[model samples]
Target: MKTIVQTPDAPAPIGPYSQAVKSGSTLYVSGQIAIDPASGELINDSIENETRQVMKNLGAILSEAGMNFSHVVKCSIFVTDMNNFAKVNAVYGEFFTSNPPARETVEVSALPKFVNVEISCIAIS
Candidate 1:
């Protein structure tokens, strides 16, 4: 069976989608931006800060599904500018310390709320 996941700690879906979906032992997390759930404010002060917020949002969703960074198997990173890749990677690395999940980062033309970064992940519980 498939289950939808959600949490108040993470930003609510701006459109018609759940924060994540779980099927069997695998959970698919939706791409997360820098929207702060509590205040619904965009956190885009700097590349690092934006990345941090995006990670935080992703963390919240994982927590809701009773999972964490260590459980993540893969990640997809999206950014409007490749110039900020290093900055984003630094913050992203902090979350996954040992045997980090496989990931790929790509440059896109734009993102919702004009944020610089967004991240999605897949985790196995």
Candidate 2:
């Protein structure tokens, strides 16, 4: 069985989906953009800031699901511009100081809200 995981600390889903879902010991977090959960506004001021917001959003969902970054086993990062990969990775690195999860960063033509970055993760509790 799966349990829907959500938190007011994270952005609400824009479509018909939950922020994250937990099944057994694994939690699957949905892709998170730079939407500010408190204001419901996009935070695209800078690539670093944008990525930070995305990570925060992911963190909130994981926390709600009773997990943390250390529990994450995999992650996927999507960026509109490959040039911003370094910036995004720097902010992401701050979250996982050691034993970082396996991740793939992909550059795409565009992303939801046209934001430069989005991130999602899978965690094992």
Candidate 3:
């Protein structure tokens, strides 16, 4: 059966969608931006900070599903500017020290809330 997952630690969905969905051992996490759930504020002061917040938001959703970075199999990262790739990668790397998940970073014209970065992942429990 499929199950929806939500958590207060992560920013609530801006639209009508759950933070994640679980089907069997796999958890599908939705794209996360830099919105801080505690204060509901956007953390876009810097690209690194924004990426950190996005990763934090993703982490919260994974935790809610009883999973972590190690369990992640793949991830999708979207950025408005390819120039910010290095900065974003640095912070994102902090989450996975070894055996990192397969991922692709794409440059786009825009993202929700016009943030510089957004990330989503798939994990197994």
What's model 1's overall lDDT? Answer: 0.95
TM-score of candidate 2 against the unseen true structure: 0.98
- Distance from true position, residue 114, model 1, in Å? 1.1
Worst 10 residues of 2 by lDDT: 59-68
Per-residue alpha-carbon lDDT of model 3 for 24-121, expressed as tens digits? 99999999999999999999999999999999999999999988999999999999999999999999999999999999999999999999999999
Residue-level error in angstroms, candidate 3, position 108: 0.3
Per-residue lDDT of candidate 2, residues 1-125 (tens digit): 99999899999899999999889999999999999999999999999999999999999898888788999999999999998878898999999999999999998998988889989899999
Candidates 1 and 2, the one with greater lDDT: 1
Candidate 1, residues 70-106, lDDT tens digits: the string is: 9999999999999898999999999998999999999
Q: lDDT (0-100) at residue 19 of candidate 3?
A: 95
Would you list the clashing residue pairs of candidate 1? none
- Of candidate 1, the 10-residue stretch with the lowest lDDT total is 110-119
Candidates 2 and 3 compared: the better one by lDDT is 3
Cα TM-score of candidate 3: 0.98
TM-scores of the candidates are 0.98, 0.98, 0.98
